[model samples]
Target: MTVAGWETRKNVPLVGHQVLLQYRKGTSGAFVTPKKVRTDRDGWATATVKATADGAYRYDFAGTSLTRATTGSADFVDVK
Candidate 1:
């Protein structure tokens, strides 16, 4: 199945916000492929990942001239 995630601010959808999708493997590997995505009309950002080991995923919002930086929560994936 495909995995997806979203972003919001102060209960409002952050439409067109830039999000970076990242992943790290088994608590040892560095994060890779900071995929760029723009928030949709509903503040949603989605990424598709194929994993070969257990790892954690996170999304980062690099602060822009007008927007402060923030990070999304990390979720772990156990690949079989």
Candidate 2:
């Protein structure tokens, strides 16, 4: 699913908002090193991952503050 864009609710300009995505085997397992991403002009970004085999995959999207994450298993097979 595509994430909605975020708007800075602060009174000042929000610069350098960093984003990280972590994927792991399970909820109790260690979080894998996430690829660095930045919010677009509309504070939104997307990542397309392919599954090597049939298994469970979980992802987390974090920024300097709280942000939404994507989850579910639907057989990821391509980047596009």
Candidate 3:
């Protein structure tokens, strides 16, 4: 699967920063290991994740730069 998002603060994109992609199998399931990716000039970052099984999955982003930390969630993904 491919996870992608934009990093912004106060409506401004944060460039050259790192964002972590974290995933879990189900709503009540524990999250697996996370993947780290860097934001491009447009503040967009993406990570490729390999699903372990077919199920409902969720993902979120975590990032910090210059003492500022941010977290954002993406829409759920259904893997077959």
Number of the predicted model whose lDDT against the real structure is largest:
1
lDDT of each: 0.74, 0.44, 0.57
Model 3 stretches with alpha carbons more than 4 Å out: 1-12, 54-68
What's the CA error at residue 45 for candidate 1, in Å? 1.0
In the order shown, the candidates' Cα RMSDs to the true structure are: 7.0, 6.9, 6.8
On lDDT, who's better, 1 or 2? 1
Tens digits of per-residue lDDT, candidate 3, 1-80, equal: 12233353334556766666767665557665467777777667777877765434333445343334545554466666
- Flag regions of model 1 displaced more than 4 Å: 1-11
Best by TM-score: 1
- TM-scores for all candidates: the values are 0.70, 0.44, 0.57
| Colliding residue pairs in candidate 3 | none
- Kindly indicate the candidate among 2 and 3 with the higher TM-score: 3
Cα lDDT of model 1 overall?
0.74
Clashing pairs in 2: none
C-alpha RMSD between model 1 and the true structure: 7.0
